[model samples]
Target: MSASNRPAGSGRLLTGVAWATLLLGLWLWGRGITDGSGASSAPTTGDIAAVGRPHGVLLPAAHAPIKGTAPERIEIPSIGVRAPVVARGLDKAGGIDPPPFAKSQTVGWYGSGTRPGAAGAALLVGHVDTETKPAVFYGLSAARPGAKVRVVRTDGSVAEFTIDDVQVFTRKRFDARKAYGPRKDGRAELRLITCGGTFDRASHEYNANVVVSAYLTGEKPSAGKSA
Candidate 1:
């Protein structure tokens, strides 16, 4: 049965990284990063355009080239989030693992994919809530377009991206390719993901996944790397 059609509490618990496993349909069957499709490809993934709302925040407009650096931290000043970033690999189930629930204040960067600030879509995933309370990305849905997301890298470079889109996709209709794929061939982009929408106590799952899309707008190299 489709996820949307399922009863509120009819969620399944899968093995492996519990948080990431909750999204088995996401990182596994839904990933189409190279499909070149967007939110319009299918009914399940919902409509990306519908979720993106304009905002009044001002952001840098200068675009930067990809640096391929390993991100160490992420700061979304608009939402008052300043969290350490840890490298995460997929579990045996192919689901990208998130930081342990105990580390609710941290986020995870997909070490297998394009590094943040690179010329492709970089993915960052986090938990919205744990079994008992709020987590790192708990307020991610409150972010607005034109807001800035800053990523500090191991190389000492800080990549700044401008938020332009945000949407929540239901697991059943999730189109991984369209949601994670690049919209432009060479533009550096970002996708911040976490569980969103209503929580299903019976299903032990979230009704949808929040996806925040951004693009590299500027970069500042560490003091030593600065010319």
Candidate 2:
């Protein structure tokens, strides 16, 4: 969806805003989410109805999407998060795969979507906790506005994004369309996701998710690209 043309309930999960055209459809295909929650029931008829009427917007031409090098690492200093970024693809169920439990400190980039320095919203997902302890994004829900998220890419450049907002969405109200959609049109953006809130022992899942929204403010020089 266009950044300027967000559907109704725009700030929410479902114009499911700016991640990219294919994001809402493919990214949410969860492979048990890969940790243990298993597949989710399909959205209701209302949801199916709302998806058909998406919105759009136009922006100044300067913020065109730039193709970026594949990312290698991600760093969030305030939360003491620094980890390797592995390119993850869709699992059979269709959700973007997350970092495996064994590698608690790692983060996973949705390789099929926008690249770090690219024009559209790039997605990065990680675990909030594992069976025994907190995971790499454990403090994700605590992030406040203006926090910096740095992505080091293969071209030796660093994509720096500033956190615009950090929100927690409950499983019951999880709107995959809104959560994965873009907020601003024509600007490079990022969405960092992880589980949050209380863990539901009955379902073996986190009751909520922490979604941090950021935009490309600048970049570190590399591969002939100037700062």
Candidate 3:
């Protein structure tokens, strides 16, 4: 189920051409995206079939974009995730390198892209499970709209975001731009991604991906600093 703890290279999530395609979409359309539809053949938690903003759910307004520093840590309160963030770039194969399986609990940020809390969408990827057990983002599919995600920056500010959309996009229907691009211009956005759907025995990979989208709602000043 864990792709032997190797989520990227072993035909899991961000495999060779798939990763390149994603980056291409990100480059072609720098920011802003619309909602899409689709579902996973193998559902997890609840029905994850392209769950967008729930009806009647009033989300907070997007916070103004801020100058962002490198993220030191990330917290998803609903999922009980508190993990360190590490910068990751393209590997030799030209695909976005994910965090090593040995450090399955860590989160990998696309260092070359927009920083979290910045004007554009920041990309954060993690493994859903390991060979032995669930990994960092195991409960990502269960995350619903209105969940809170907090990113602690190196500069000491804590950027808080509210989840707005969650989708289980199958490989055939996955839109890289929609999954990773900003939802609105001039507002900071975040995407939490992991492998989802059922594991394909033939391909040795997951059939779908779980993408959780969020936007900055507020910022807590650095510790001991006046707001």
Candidate 4:
């Protein structure tokens, strides 16, 4: 994705700090963000064209970044996703250890990375599906640009993000920096990631990843009501 994927004039750089950490994060993320169950199931990933906003869908102005806060839950009304958030770190293999398959409905935040509502891009990852059923982000690909994504934080504030871009990047074209970096400097951003593309039973993993990019556009003291 590029500036065209965001509202005009919203460009930013991936600071050295973000770049260096993302290098290691991407290493594991690109190898395959999540594992598969191998059993045949309906694919949940979307097409590559999912990138960029739909023609004429105007987006809202960016909201000033807020103080760092831990996310407690995530809600995407467009997709009917209301899931609890959990903090997860790198596994022994150096890859982000996502919420276990048994907890398919949970979302995992990169606890070591940027906190939600902060300047850097906060990353939340989840499984797309399992051998027998759909997972937390199963309908993520179906989410359209301009839709709202609300993150309930621990500080009694809710970080509201507007969907700006959604892309399905295959392993070959998965650029860690571009996929995970902030779209606008100094503006709070969020990246929702999950295994996408066709599930290769032989390898037991998906061929691509669904990356949903959003930027902070609103906030409230708590999840009092919908925006």
Judged by lDDT, which candidate is best? Answer: 3
Q: lDDT of candidate 3 vs native?
A: 0.75
Per-residue lDDT of 148-189 in model 2, one digit per residue for the tens?
A: 888998988888887776665555556665556567777888
* Model 2 bad stretches (over 4 Å): 1-65, 223-227
Model 4 backbone overlap count: 0
Candidate 4 matches the true fold with a TM-score of 0.77
How accurate locally is residue 8 in candidate 3, as Cα lDDT from 0 to 100?
Answer: 48
Clash total of candidate 1: 8
Top TM-score model: 3
Model 1 compared with the native: what TM-score? 0.79
lDDT per model, in order?
Answer: 0.70, 0.61, 0.75, 0.72
The reply for model 1, stretches above 4 Å from the true place, is 1-51, 55-62
Output the worst ten-in-a-row residue range by lDDT, candidate 2. Answer: 45-54
Tens digits of per-residue lDDT for model 4, 1-227: 12224233221111122222333456554565623222122234634235445688899999999778899999999999999999988767565656755677899998988899999799998867655677888888888899999999987788999999887665544567667777778989999987666665554446566778999998897556444
RMSD of each: 6.1, 12.6, 4.2, 11.9
**Candidates ranked by TM-score:** 3, 1, 4, 2
TM-score, candidate number 2: 0.70
Worst 10 residues of 3 by lDDT: 10-19
Instruction: Give candidate 2's total backbone clashes.
Output: 18
